[model samples]
Target: MTDPWNPADPGVLRLPSGRLVRGRGLRRPLDGSAPTPSYALYLLGRQPPPVTWEFRWIRWPDFRLPADRAEARAALTEAWERAAGERVEIACGGGRGRTGTALACLAVLDGVPAEEAVDFVRSHYDRRAVETPWQKRYVRRF
Candidate 1:
């Protein structure tokens, strides 16, 4: 079995239930010092570059919602489930919008109220997470 992510890792966010999911920006260089994720979810409008580890890609354009809401749900749910016993990472080009939105949804799955999930992520992950008003609304309705 894979080991869990270090809560102190640069992009790791510890959910209220103690699951650790790392959210990152594809625009930034990955910190080489951090351990790689056992599984990852990449949110992008187009196919992303392949990696050595297992991964999934959702056609989620930058600053926008996922193209297939159902696919996003399944992918995020899988990511959250794996994070309990593996290092799972969720990433988008800029990481704040799509990544943050997905993280909030995972928060909801982890038992955070949908209305409060966004705040929970912003407080523990990035201060500017869930970038747009619609994204915040999405979290609320998740």
Candidate 2:
């Protein structure tokens, strides 16, 4: 199955491997017209509100990294793999810092070089993604 999110949809980021994942901010109002993701990873300080779709919550504070690095990796890898067929999404409170970092990491899993993943996400997803220095470093080391 080659089901994928529409490239023109809000927050959609097409990875180098041709996998599509949407990145969004939970703090903002979700677009009612937008398609819902089959699976989503929420990088947030606390558990997100229950949604109709399946989701995993990673304890990632705003402007910070995941509390459990190993778990984050596993969850990110799951999201990346699922993106091959499912409509995967990566999200956070503001969607630029934590969300961007996760997207960059996903890029790495999708065959993008770790060093260039941040740039790739910024160019295609959000101009101000991967907000902090540590976030960029994390992507580089991912």
Candidate 3:
């Protein structure tokens, strides 16, 4: 699996429409050379620190589930739309669980079958992705 935070890597996923989106971990310092995202989705249990880039937060606890399903869907759909025309990123504390889950959802939005999205992200991004069963189920339901 590629290091999601690596500037050279970006851990990008190319959608069926040819749009690219990146997934990353907020816990690690971002690589200075990485391309700056025009928009970002930060999935965390609490509010994120202020940032200059346009961003949205989904109240998602680590190794757990999102606080609100409807909100998560709306935010993820927005992120997916933005990724079609701009650099977009989805991130979480460790970049594995929540980030992977979000990325899998994006994969589903990208035309991947929902049932396959989790495995798709795990193989393409990180082996340890989607750390919990519910996260996997969430991807399927996305």
Task: Arrange candidates, best TM-score first.
Answer: 1, 2, 3
Model 3, 1-142: lDDT tens digits are 1222233465776666666778888888777866667889999999998888899999999999899999999999998887767778889999999999999998898899999998888888888889999999999888
lDDT of every predicted structure (CA atoms): 0.91, 0.93, 0.85
Expressed as tens digits, the lDDT of each residue in 11-124 for candidate 1 is 799998899999999888776777888999999999999888999999998888999988898999999999989989999998889999999999999999999999998999
* RMSD (Å) per prediction: 0.9, 1.1, 4.2
lDDT by residue (tens digit), candidate 2, 40-80: 99999988999999999999999988999999999999999
Among all windows of ten consecutive residues in candidate 3, which has the lowest summed lDDT? Answer: 1-10
* Candidate 2 global CA lDDT score: 0.93
TM-score-superior candidate, 2 or 3: 2
Which 10 consecutive positions of candidate 2 have the poorest summed lDDT? 1-10
At residue 104, what lDDT does model 2 achieve?
A: 97
* Every model's TM-score: 0.97, 0.96, 0.91
